[model samples]
Target: MLTIEQATYDAIVAHAKRDHPDEACGIVAGPEGSDRPERFVEMVNAAGSPTFYEFDSTDLLHLYQEMDRADEEPVVIYHSHTATEAYPSRTDIGLAMEPNAHYVLVSTREHGNNDGPVEFRSYRIVEGEVTEEPVSVVDAFPR
Candidate 1:
């Protein structure tokens, strides 16, 4: 299961909604080896396609360097799907390089910028295999 704070979840949903029609992509970084997602880092979708999402290479490189300097690792990698369900596509599965990161997919098909519920789901994609996971949203992580 993927446990997340409500604010983090809301931020991700908002980003997805804001980038509707063009997939939004981002990552939440936390201390290396820590599964907790504590920092939100919205990214540019280089593909900028309704059906596909890709992190800009330059931005990705910079993010990696920054994370390294901060002793952080991406705990959650997320993207939005404008017209499909919150499931990983073949390409997405193929691009799963972070075996330890939670892959999140948010679908804005139902509402499409309207004030309606969206499909937010999480998964584990490792070695081309996709496994859907449960998500638990909490006000905050207990101290």
Candidate 2:
């Protein structure tokens, strides 16, 4: 399972909508835990299209430094699909670098005016297979 904060979730959604007509990508930062994972957004980049995602290495380096300073290793890499479901594409399957790291995809389809079902989903890309995982986002304040 993967746990993400509500603010981070909103950020991802916003990024997705903002970059609609193209794909949006970013890094998910937080301390990894068995449950109640504390995750947040580190950066956002615009991917060219459904076929390719361009991650700025400099941005990644910056995120790495920040994570290192916070003693938090990157546990997830997230992106969005503007016209499809929250599932890994062929390119995504081919580019799965960290098998253990969580892969999150936000589907912006049907999300006109930013008022669509929160299509936040998690997966693990291992050996070309994208395995779905459970995910939850914590509110800003505990209920």
Candidate 3:
């Protein structure tokens, strides 16, 4: 299961909603080798397409460099689906290079930019294989 804090979850949903018709993409970073998602970093989608998302090469490089300095790794890779279900597309699966990261998909189809619940789901994509996983949202992580 992918365990995330309620605040982080809310922020992710909000970002998804704010993006509206375009797909919102981001990554949550945590200590290296740790599965906990601690830092939420919203990213600009270079593709700017409702059906696709791409991280700008320069921005991605900067993020990685910063993460390296902080001894952090991307624990969660997320994107919003404006029109489809909260599931990974073939392209998403193909592009997933992080073997240990949780891939999250949020669907805003039911209430585009409105006040309503969205379909938030998590998955594990490794080597082109996709596996749906359960999510646990808590107030905070235990110290």
Candidate 4:
């Protein structure tokens, strides 16, 4: 299961809604080896396609370097799908490189940009295998 704060979840959904029609991608970083998602880092979708999402190579490199220096790791990697369900595509499964990170997919097909329901789901993609997971939104993480 992926447990996250409500504010973090809302921020991700907002970013996805803001970038509707084009996939929104980002990451939530936490302390190294920590599964808790504490920091939201919205990213540019290099692909800029409704059906696809790719982090900008330059931005990804810099982000990784910064994370390393800060002793942080990406606990959640997320993207939005404009027209599809909140599920990973074949390409997404093929590109799963973070076995330890939660892969989140948010679908804005039902509501587009207006105020309506969206499909927000989490998954674990490891070595081309996809496993859907449960999500729990809380007010905050315990100290």
Query: What's the true lDDT of residue 14 in model 2?
Result: 84
Residue 73 miss distance in model 1 (angstroms) = 0.5
Candidate 2 lDDT, 1-143, residue by residue in tens: 77777877787778777777677887765564433335556454535675457787787777788878887766778887877788988988898887768898988778733666747799989999888999876775343
Q: Write out the backbone clash pairs for model 1.
A: none
Writing each residue's lDDT as its tens digit, candidate 4 over 1-21 gives 999999999999999999998
Cand. 3 TM to true fold: 0.98
Backbone clash count for every predicted candidate, in the order shown: 0, 0, 0, 0
Cα lDDT computed for each candidate against the true fold: 0.94, 0.74, 0.96, 0.95
Residues 1-143 of candidate 1: C-alpha lDDT, one tens digit per residue: 89999999999999999999899999999889879999999999998889898899999999999999999999999999999999999999999999999999999999987798999999999899899999999999877
Cα misplacement distance, residue 33 of candidate 1 (Å): 1.4
lDDT of 3 at 103: 98
Clashes of 3: 0
lDDT score for residue 12 of model 3: 94
Candidate 3: tens digits of C-alpha lDDT, residues 79-106: 9999999999999999999999999999
lDDT of 1 at 59: 96
Scored by lDDT, the top model is 3
Q: Kindly report which residue pairs in candidate 4 clash with one another.
A: none
Off by over 4 Å in 3: none
Q: Which whole-number lDDT from 0 to 100 does residue 43 have in model 2?
A: 58
